[model samples]
Target: MKANKETKRLFVGGLGQAISETDLQIQFSRFGEVSDVEIITRKDDQGNPQKIFAYINIKVAEEDLKKCMSVLNKTKWKGGTLQIQLAKESFLHRLAQEREEAKSKKEKSTTGNTNVSEKMGGIDFQMKAVPGTEVPGHKNWVVSKFGRVLPVLHLKNQHKRKISFVICFSE
Candidate 1:
């Protein structure tokens, strides 16, 4: 996929399973400032071994990155031909997108409870603040997939209700 404009992190796939982060970082440092390198590892249950992939965060000057990518793409490292490109939107960014989609779906599903609170930890909470009421209405009420209304403890006047985290079930 084409890199987003602000993307400076490179995704290094086709990595030899034995390759380490330090080796990857050292190899890519020649192109620009190597700010960070992350190697993701997950336990392969069937294989019973760690499967690894790497992401490198480089801080090359804006124009220099294109040059770096042009020269380094398809280069070999650690016994594997490298397939590199700018990293996609991060996990947190993806979470925000999910939250927005959930919010829109929630609005359509309910009586247009169009009062979701600002994002906290990339999660948009339910907002029950009435327009003119002296007491804050509710915060973070949970609604279930099967239409079970679980009331979470949103402590302002301390509504004594236990609720599950609200989420949109429809895709």
Candidate 2:
């Protein structure tokens, strides 16, 4: 027995790697206006990624999902079963997490907590960010994950190749 709140996003799991975001967006369009299709993946210890699952966001309210949930759930898609659930928690978590982070950041700023970049005057390179190339002359800085600051090279990303964004840093 689900509640009557109208949520636009839905969690779609039990996905196969073969499914593309466009494929999902097209398939889900039959129910309502598909806003975005996000496929969440998992990374191995070696840093290689593997597909885990996906999510579909519709433009209409939860009533749209309620109308189409039965038809899409457990349906065979790309030779795999698709599981769909309302993304009520997704919305709630996003709001709650933002509030929590803002509070934490405020506390850190008030206490004069200095970051690594402030002392070192350079950026921390994670496994995926830094490219094997010279730094660019333009751009001031690049923000890292978890709102960390880093002065970095200007990166060029290709938008035409596919839906995935690929940024290439060059000399």
lDDT of 2: 0.64
Error of 1 at 87 (Å): 1.1
What TM-scores do the predictions have? 0.50, 0.46
Kindly list the per-residue Cα lDDT of model 1 for residues 22-141, writing each as its tens digit: 898788787677878888766676765455678888877656677877776788767667788888868766767766887677566645433333222223323432222222244444
lDDT of 2 by residue, 62-93 (tens): 66666688788998888678888876557556
Poorest stretch of ten by lDDT in candidate 2: 162-171
The number of the candidate with the highest TM-score is 1
Alpha carbon lDDT of each predicted model? 0.62, 0.64
- Candidate 2 residue 125 Cα shift, in angstroms, is 26
Q: Clashing pairs in model 1?
A: 151-163
Task: Please list all clashing residue pairs in model 2, or write none if there are none.
Answer: none
* Candidate 2 stretches greater than 4 Å from native: 1-7, 43-51, 61-63, 91-93, 96-171
